[model samples]
Target: MKKNTYLLPILRTAYESLTKSEKRIADCISADVTTFIGMGIAEIADRTDSSEITVNRFCKKLGFAGLQALKLALASVPSEEVISEEGFAKEDSYQHIAEKIFQNIQNGLADTLSLLDYDAVEEAVEALLAARRIVVFGVGNSATICQDFETRFLRFGSIVEAYSDVHQQATVASLLSAEDVVVAISHSGATREVLDTTAIGKAAGATVISITSRMGSPLAKLSDIVLIGMGREVRYRSEATASRLVHMAIIDILYTGIALRRKDYAANIAKMRTVIRVRKQ
Candidate 1:
């Protein structure tokens, strides 16, 4: 994680959609973030030729709580040389491309870890543990993550299912009860099918846990527990590509937490090991 790592990527990602005033602020900060970091909200507004309210709005648009949160993020950034591995180039060597991909994943993981709420994660774990049935909803790349979740939790003898088909997801969601849990994964947090299905699950009295990058997105709004991730896009990679690993890491955390809390966890693992040994022959 370099200085302004997440900040710079965020500015780039949100630049086009920003209002004129917000763009001015983004430009000022992008031009010289170090100087901007030293300024207060009023000072920033003055520097960008915008109002204090606009400055605050800009910060929130970029996913921070306010200008103060943005400032803290900037202040925390350590000054370092921007490496070419941050972006890809036709002239880059194979090793360089690999390094760039690895760097992006590392930065994304670090960003998500920084924003993770342990209490929310624990809450999600508890929901899964108590769930009579765990149904995961996802689409596209997210569907793969849903499958991963099912594969991991099913080993513990949990009644888990991952649904990628929109129709099936909606059907299952409609039938769920308070004893069920729905784990929804979406990078943008605004996928229509995911939101729709999750809403059904929510309406059915099931616990809804959302893993998403956008906290203010509709999916997050529908969720009972929200786990936010910082998944900035790389040059050629979509935001989903960057977010996939972060989501998987969160799943891993939840899986381990639930596994550890289970009284029969050791016995389950021992039985699984014996089964594997017998199957190998």
Candidate 2:
């Protein structure tokens, strides 16, 4: 785990890889991390119905040296940073469901904001400003976000394109030069098409920027600058829901930064408005 890695996400990501007993421990800890913070190895073992040895093994799997180390890491995470997966219950009232949904969104945004590295964000804005052409790539829900970014960048009168098709992305990447930039958006950061496109862009000398939740993901490794978003998966909603909101927020930050740097940004906006008005007439 990297510095400031949230415990709940780590447990969730590693859940599939753990043994049945280890999974029980993971579930117990993830459900209420604050409660687990005060627990000893013996207490955890009892809760999970496993031995102390099994609990130790589970801790090691999550990159902790021991139960003590794991607890320390969990303790470091602020209470607000822990994302609780509150699955929708069929027995719940409509108002209850609405409140839970709003709470999840609030937590997701706050977590992403906390995880953002402003230095990386500044570098990303500089790269965008310097590039002669910018190409954005994503698929599925991420592609929708890429398109939104493309639309936003157009206000700056820069050469930008968003490609959802894998073949188009490859072709665009093949033509990229050192003067170009590529922004790849992937929540998992392990999407095959997005990774391949990013690799091509890098090989062609374009500066690659990755927006992902996973810190040490393949996409992050390939990027010249990485903007991390902390979005947790919820059982009743699409996995990308919170991540998409974070991604949009990041895009807005970049858009604002780039707009501020351009001398004629206001003039460009006026011209765009005038053009729209003329078309309406």
Candidate 3:
């Protein structure tokens, strides 16, 4: 009941030990426990073509008393929180819409923290730290993501160059070399501009780091290393807000890592004085 945190890992272990039919139910439950949690033993059994008794045994194997305890654990399972525009749209008011969107933003931030892969992030830090120059490439809506990464990297004393324009990004890619590091970002991993630009960097022998979604995507395949940005996606959503959050989360991790490593990067950044000085004079 209170062992849901330990449940998945144990299930994964049991799954490794399971017989063929038992593994079927484990696979179904593991795929999306949220849905499985809401479903009944009979319903799930019917769906998976397994028996209720088999499902109960699978549950007991994972240290649950029975299926009911497993269901309760699933019910208590903390799902990723996201704001739904469609749900808010039904409310039909501007204020309500605003509130829901903000909630989604908050939830997106939370979800980002929940799914962040620290090991991959540490590798990214080492990449940025080890690179002679860092070139960030993104296009269209993702171009803004590139700029954000550039800003954060620049603050850490890395020579970061970012391009949102396709032509300029292409030109920047041409200057890339093995001594350089390139981070290409695309939520779908299908942006032609980003893919093409990253290809140029890769061809020039720069270490390629792809921040993308699908594991088997082209960009993912091309990367020397990747930081997978996974999130709970909602239907008909803009993707902009969630994708930006994904980009920012990685940048934030890199920023914090670099700042910690250099120790003085933050202080140096804080010393910048604005040009508005002589007002009293």
- Once fitted onto the true fold, the runs of candidate 1 whose alpha carbons sit more than 4 angstroms away are 1-27, 40-43, 46-50, 57-73, 81-85
- Across residues 1-281, which tens digit of lDDT does each residue of candidate 3 receive? 12534344334323434666678887777678888878888998898888988888877766678888877766664554212434534545898767656665565555445444567778888888889999888876777888888866776666899888878878888888888999998876767778888898899889998886544466867788876554334454656565577667777777888888987775767643222244435
Scored by lDDT, the top model is 2
Ranking by lDDT: 2, 1, 3
| Maximum-TM-score candidate | 1
Give the per-residue lDDT of model 2 (tens digit) for 121-179: 99999999999999999998899999999999999989999999999999999999999
What's the ranking of the predictions by TM-score, best on top? 1, 2, 3
Candidate 1 lDDT score relative to the true structure: 0.82
Worst 10 residues of 1 by lDDT: 77-86
Backbone clash tally (model 2): 0
Residue pairs in clash, model 1: none
Cα lDDT tens digits for candidate 1, 25-117 = 988986787889888888888878899999989888777888878887776655662322256678999998787777777877776766676
lDDT of each: 0.82, 0.85, 0.70
RMSD for each model, in Å, please?
A: 3.9, 4.5, 7.8
Off by over 4 Å in 2: 1-73, 79-81, 91-93
